[model samples]
Target: MSSPVKVYVYDLSKGLAGQVSLQLTGKQIDGVWHTSVVAFGKEIFYGPGICETEPGRSHHGSPLRIVDMGETHMDEQTFVEYLSQIKEHYTADKYHLLDFNCNSFTNDCLGFLTGGSLPPYIKDLPSDFLSTPFGAALRPTIDAMFRGRASTGVLTPPPDISATADSSNPASASSLLQAVAAGATSNNSEMPSSSRNYLPTPAPTSPPTPVQSNSLTTPVHIATNPSSFHNVLHTHRAVVAFFTSATCGPCRMIEPVFEDLAKSKSRANDVAFVKIDLGVGMSNAVGGEYGVRVTPTFILFLDGNKTHEMKGINAPELRTQVDLLLYQAFPPHRHTTLSLPAIEAIPLNAILSSQVPNLDIVLAKVTGFIDAAPSWSGSTTKEATKQILAKNIIPYLKARGSSSPPNTSFEPWKDATISLVTNLSAGELFPVADMWRVALLEPAVCSWSATKFGPGSPILVLLSKAEGAPRNYSLTFLRMISNAFANKIVARELLLSSRSSITALMVAALFHDDATVRLAAANLAFNMTMHLQRLRVEKVRGNVEGDDVGENEEWDIEMTSALLEVIEREKANEEIVHRLTASLALSIRLSPSIEQLASLLEVLQAQKILKDKLERGGCGDTGVVKKEARKLIEEVAEKLCS
Candidate 1:
């Protein structure tokens, strides 16, 4: 059975915040919200590290509001194990009032449990508070009050709480489970004290197990056998193995340094640091295999082959070699060698529109169109289409705009939309296209549509039909394409497998006689460029999995060609020019092969076209968009073309 999750919202300031917030921050605030996730009969929160209690039994007393956070299909044991893995990241020392606090913890837990997040008003309060002058002035004071109060050891539950079976296994569960059994059994009215303490030692029969891969920050892997030693080297791209013995004083001295390195670097899956004790069972044979004659021997392995070795306890050398090993294992992107400051500063965040249109009016218009059409007269298809729109699509779109709506089955909607678009005339498609334009803003809907339909999705088909249709149909179609960038999955499809068709549509729309259609096309172009740029940034950070570099390069070249073609034709609209230039700048800057792109720019004489645009300003020349465009264009020219 799926467990129902809820967010318990407490007022940290009691009643004082609501009364004084307007005077202090120049804004009327309701309450100082502190949220906690209630799941599996326990109330889990973070403050002085991850803490727990019975629902509504925390020191904050009853919640002012309890937001229903849907349900989690995750099993209890797996969820407990997940918490243990993230416990170190939420330690008491890491907590901050305006930063990593209770709300942040609950937000993360809710997302993990149900793929949802806390409401914007609750999660965004800290930034809203900090944006004010008085709040900014009070930051240091707030920091001083909460700082230096970190618990010295593992956080323990309050005294009234009894340990659960899951709590006994600290290796597999975090302190969040400490009160589950007590909360389940107790009926006391008195709340437990919200104090931080150390957990009592477990029974001797239940010996603490070594930390596993789940907790990479605590990196002490005791390799007792050769297979275990080789396994670490095999799994990780780079391995730093420290051979140590109990008798060596130098080994004891440098062990802490090795651990610190492991804590810093081991979080990435491709690197590992293992400490092999020669004195432990079967560890001596593993040491002998590597020809280790003395204690404090370090060996560096890359791709399961020993590459470098060091003797004695030299912390500086060990640090230097480890850095070199990682540098060699994952080489930096070639773009890092460039001197393009302006391009490097470009924000890669995707431009997504979240505005929800008046759904009632949209539904009325859609149903009205269907009811009035002679094509729908005396047919069950008319009623079925309205039912799907009113019952399934409209409610889903409304709920999805505000919260993580349940994953309602979209197969019916998908089949119905495809069928309608395939059969409907271009003049009759605006209502359906407009509804989809709004629905595509929701990432789940966008992703589902892309996956269900592949290259021949209804949206793409609508775009094809709307090419020469009326302004309303064409504008709505372009807007729908622009909103597809809000979801990465569909955005990637538009950039990759569906690139040729989308490129043709965008190129044709860019030269449209209608300025609004051209502007919409430009906005679509910018959104696609931004998505590709984001992937490039992620690739540089080593966070992106798979081959984003090749895909980005391919899209950059093709998008540059398309943008350059339209730039010469766009004469009057500074808005279209601005978007086109911005998209071009993003595509050209910090590219994997800047030299190749510069060569392309040279071939196309992009410098002259951009310079000519600057010399002969737009028709209504406010010069703001033109000036920003020039700054970005000049940066590109100086860095790439010059």
Candidate 2:
């Protein structure tokens, strides 16, 4: 007989997916809404319908599954209906394990059941599936209670089956016997479908042969044979748990992707990765205790217990949740513009709005992308970025556009724009490459100058808000840049952007010019006197038309050293300075090896020169003009000394 279909299922906590379930939000119905198909070894499969979930009975990591017959043409719509019936008739006690994507499998069953005549697409399901019109036949209805569609409490918490069989009914035992028989018989052709018949003891004459209770007793933890349950991380450490089902079609497709994601996120030392499977049957009762009802759920455990849960998520969401969870748990030991959300948001745009210009430009591009991007891949979180853009940014822009209080222009730049086109001039917007001749040289165009260094203690103030507001999309792009740099991909991409050293640097200069970076860099330079690489003071004496250009500019070693000393010593906060300085040191150490070494050599030489100047004029009767200078020098000297 064909093996009894085993599936993993979880009882969702209302706090996570349950809350999402309540919101009933997502683009699932416009076709491929929360659903998309993936190939199983080249054959398409979709799965783990929500109705198939067994509430209260299922654990946190249940493996509700798909009966993996190779690709079938069953429409996701028909598939949705068929599983609802399966969930009702077979219910919890009938199978070895419940499939999370059971409905999809059921639709697939009809493909086989009706001699492979299932409709190829949901739109072809005929009008009847929508609501029972004259030609509208009733399609399979899901447990609509969660969706607020209608109360199809067909598979709700059966108080008896949940917590000991409701004892009020004396015939409950006999009834359960009959149900079990039907469930077992229905599962296999070889076994008499009704083999386990309702055989009640002879009128309660003697103690009955202890019949196992009809109620599904959820074990504390049940794991598949290859699966294991682990606390993995103690309260003192970070924890990441991978939730999965063995038979699920979508889960199978995403497993490799997940493995890649987890590998990138996990560190064997501080962060822990534990894999949970509901398919392990009675082996992993511990997972059952947590109510894992879905396939491929990722639970972010902080300080030993689940602080956040990511269910029906894909590699990207998994990556995001891990990042945010890790950051919150461990408090990253570095200053960064790349916060958790930004990390997810940035790469998200990089992948989605890839052709768009700057982050601000992409804000408009966000709407166009959402309108055309297609919906979520069936039962996976991969397309979550598209979904999120639709939910958050797209709607926001739509509202702004409709209000039309201003901004009527269609041009990319329609306003009286004053951009600090300077940073883009030297194309320092590109990379750290040096000494490459380029005809791309336009006169230096400086856009921004600090607002007189700010009255509130040396804060940077971008002068022209003329183009609109200063973009704060930094959070999104920050993570992307962080990942790009972390992977050395930015450098590699710069090289590949063009074999021309200039082009790569041009790209780097613009891309890294985001304000978050400057602030992050400034913060890194905070409170600490670390070596500044590339510290040459160019001498320029010229008219606006470039006369007197013969002036020879020399690198003023001691004065530059003094400026460097002031920059480090003037850190507003001691602790911040200490941290930023240490981070600054680390960043330089991580810079491209050869060029940075030369920069370091120059800094060291400059430091020596400055030290000599201080030592040579020690406590001399320097003029009143030099007294203030003496004080500054002594302060810098004391800092260097200590």
Candidate 3:
């Protein structure tokens, strides 16, 4: 059943404020009241500037008027999730008094909720007020107060893992630990609380070994000495150490508590849990660092800094303090979260890897026919175009494969040859079998690379020349080949068999200054990368494998690095973001080393690509691309941290 959604609007300037506004601008205007969506009696509000969304609170006081937007097919939870996405993109930082403000937020919500926007008068009020000379002079004061109120009225909620990219709440240490612990051992089953009642197990005679817990929980490392504890702290981004003496009765009471905390939900946060024995005979140096002088002491370190410490016999207090400290250390933000869906790997079958029968003869016949054509005759040219388009030549090419097509011999028939390749690519079912055969004969033609084809590839050669029909045609032909890569079989052949040289050439083309060319290249790159990534994912899952499938199937870093370089070099290029997003996503999936991931993040941060996601007003495919890219980046960061 459809649910009722209402937009509650409050007019702050309805009284004296409206009078003042009228006197200043010769127009009667009410001060702005915050807007929120209410469903099932619960109000959903977003604070001014880019802030996290919370239920049951409004930065702006009570609404003066509530307008019903009618029924929505979406349920309450789904609707709120949608609002969260909007909040991630439409940040408070981008709020402008005359442009984007609270009213804009309301309008967007209304549009999404009811397929309509607020009244035009209300939506245009701020801009209209700013247009007058008197209002223009007062703009500075108005904007300052507006921004101040937005900032001051915001009420930050406790850390929620679902917080959007702009969440600023500081999570408690325990929360952070729980998050980290959850992330680390998510694959394993949880160890029962009853099983954790035992005393600390003595260290082995040899070096410390990882304890294989039956439950899926973060590993609890035992530090025999202070130095070992220090090493554990250095290894994890967040660490919680349980310092206890074996003889202490209170330490025994809370031993199970520490173990339970370690096994808390989601083991993906990557936090480390350590147990250090500070018994009578143990080293005191580590305890001295944390100033731990009491038995059953707990110290929390975030990013190598001692953030919190507590000592007590009460298990609740111990659990509370740890939770507060860990949350503060790793305040979870949705912006950096990544969703990596496992793609089942596909094993190579005979049709995919086996050589096409008689392809060499077919390629030889097509090249020979093109080479024998008389370029000087218009009638001959017309006939050649007809034959090429009619599929008369395709049969021979499919029937017999050639070692090498006469690339140079077809200098006079360049246009006709390009047309033939373009037409073949445009077919409904991409003739992967024939296309692969043709690609093997002229690898350069597969990527439409000018350098490899030289004068023989007329379209590509003309692309580097002055802007004219040639450049346009070059983009057209490139688009066709790129489209061919969208086909599963074709993509597999290029990525696995030909070894990705074609993919590299396509990526290199993104460096071009032309917006159209760059967009086409990006689209092409998106298709190829997605196809290759899917195959890679399948390989990872053991769902797909072939004779040539390498054991370690990683993303093409050369292509990825090239894409990153392009993203870095072309930060200002409006058309490059989509392509950059795809390339970076593909690179992230390829599982680059830690250093490589860090480098990619640094470039993204420096270029403000991730930061720019907070800005409003991306439309159509560009918006969709940005959204996907943002998700991929979050996943990349998550994987790197994990």
Candidate 4:
């Protein structure tokens, strides 16, 4: 059964904003809006992160109005699972009043549940308010008001609200609702301060200007007052504050030690090192607020709360505390605990093929084809395309290949390429595809194509058209797709949005009779493996935006099967074997669930096949490529399979 989803809209200013906004900002704002999604008998909102209460019984009291959104077909269990997946993104430290707030969280939940959004007035208020002069002037004050407070992190959900209740048991849900409503009403008088209304009054005097640093490696000097100190603490997950005075001898003794620690230990945006000089003007206020009575004191704050404090020039103790804070903030991956040197040593940089073919010969072949075709007489598209090649695309590729800045815009070339791919047949498209193979090497072209066309991009379309065509068409198409990996955006789009199509194309190309076509296919595989491995490395290093482990496990499995099949039949080219082996190693190494991949390899009898190939010294003139392939295969066999 579908449940109704409603939006509970509360006026944070409690009718005061509507009365004073016009006079204050010269704009007639309706209200300072805070919205929550009401569904599954709970009022869900984001404040100190994803709080829930009975409908009409939150700390905000009664909402001004309730807007009924459409019903959601998603079951309660499924919705709760979705919430668990997204709860981290809505943490207290990440919330910004104007950027990410209650309304934003409501809109996201509404879209997930009912495929709907909050009302336009509530959604557009921040942008509208910012457009006014007074609103723009108040931005720093607003930022200080919200971000200068200590973060409470993610809140624990109320015990009465059981997210794991059975969907079929209507009585359980009814009991939960009643319990929540009673508990909320009984505690109404004792409720804590609402997140929206917890602002502290700003100081009357203006703050001191901060001494800015050029890079994250340098520690930020505290300026202004206690508010600046709080702002830095609230912004980063882990912070190390150095409290010092200019004339203190011990402060000078440990200054370089602190600088070295900042350079080595600080992570961009995640961890921060701050300096507060008590002898400096206005900065003394921060020292008083933190209650530092002595010089050369080090304090460590995690999630806006003091965790550790140290005094004097004890470098060992300071390092230990800082390392502990990092460990708590970002725990090392389980893979790091394992003994796998080969997997750990894999290079993180992408192996992009940027070699541009001779543009003069490429342009001549394309323009000559256009001139010879009987369909090209007096055609504007043909003339325009020729001009684009000679005047635009050719020169751009030549300049980019030579490492000089290209003066022309990439937009015209993109348009012409799309037109040709749409109009020409597979037989007549090889020359155009060859030209694009060179152009795709340029990052600008790949970014433009990805942004302009997205999933139905010109490169993907061209590859689809050239699928079963002649050897030349296939080779160029493979090279074009491989070169598209030059831009991460395009590569991500192709990997995620067009996974099936790209996978099928790769599998077919691997089985081609032509060695050159198979070689191009191997190159594409190597690039794809490099991209995926880079994501794995980032995730292992605790990058929040890295690709989740096992996200592409299915794709990797499919590609691995095809590669094993091709490798077993390969003869005459050691480069192909080496590239294929490298790709296979990367796919299985450091996999979140290596046992699954090892099982697949064992079922396929891969170990015996690889051993036989190793004994044969591979298929080439020299044993060099074979040696590299053997090393990769053995690494996989021992570390992955064992």
- Span of 10 residues, lowest total lDDT, candidate 2: 439-448
* Per-residue alpha-carbon lDDT of candidate 2 for residues 1-642, written as tens digits (9 for 90 to 100): 121222222221212322221112110111111111222111121211222222112212222222233443545554344434333322222221111222233333333322221122321221112211211111111111112211231232212221232222224323432333222211112222222111111111112111111111111112222212342343126766666665777777766666554434433234555555554323245456666777776667777677887667466777777678867864532222222231112111111111222334443343343334344233213244334433443343334424342322211111101111111121211211100001001001000011111221101111111112223322222222222222111222222231233222212222344544433333322211121121100101101111101111122222233334433333222222222223323223212232433354365553443334434232222211233333433333333222
Give per-residue CA lDDT, model 1, range 159-265, as digits (tens): 22122221212321222212221222111122376422111111111111110000001233435446556655666799999998768999989988997787455
Give the per-residue lDDT of model 3 (tens digit) for 1-642. 787877776543334334343323333455444455666556643322322222323433456677777876767666556554444334433333343444544544554555554454454344344433444454454345335434642212212322311112113212432322232111111322222211122211211111110011123544534434555565567788888776788888888888667644113223566776664223355677767788888887878888877777777886787667656654432222444542112112211122344544544544554455444343335456645433433443443445653333232335554544443322211232233334333333333322223343533322233123244443554465564554443444445434454555566567667777777677666666566555454433322121112322234446555665565455444446645554556545544243565575565552354334323432232332445555544444345323
lDDT of 1 at 387: 89
Task: Report lDDT (Cα) of residue 578, candidate 3.
Answer: 46
Deviation of model 2 at 38, angstroms: 7.7
Deviation in Å, model 1, residue 90 alpha carbon: 30
Clashes of each: 0, 66, 57, 0
The TM-score obtained by model 2 is: 0.24
Give residue 66's error in model 3 in angstroms. Answer: 88
Better of 1 and 2 by TM-score: 1
For model 4, residues 1-642, the per-residue Cα lDDT tens digits are 999999998765455555444334334565656678889998887655567777887766788899999898989987777666555555555555454566656766776676566675764454445544454554555455444432432222222212332122234333432332232211212344332211122111212111000000123333323544665676689999999876899999997888667745655456777776676434577788778999999999999999988999998888888889999997765446757655555565555555667788878877776776666422248889889889887777777756666677766766676666666667777878877777777655664566544434667668678667887787878888888765565676677667778778877888888888888888888888777777677666644334322266677678778888888877677778778877777776656656567788889877765555565455544432545456766766565545
Global Cα lDDT for candidate 4: 0.64
lDDT of 1 at 618: 33
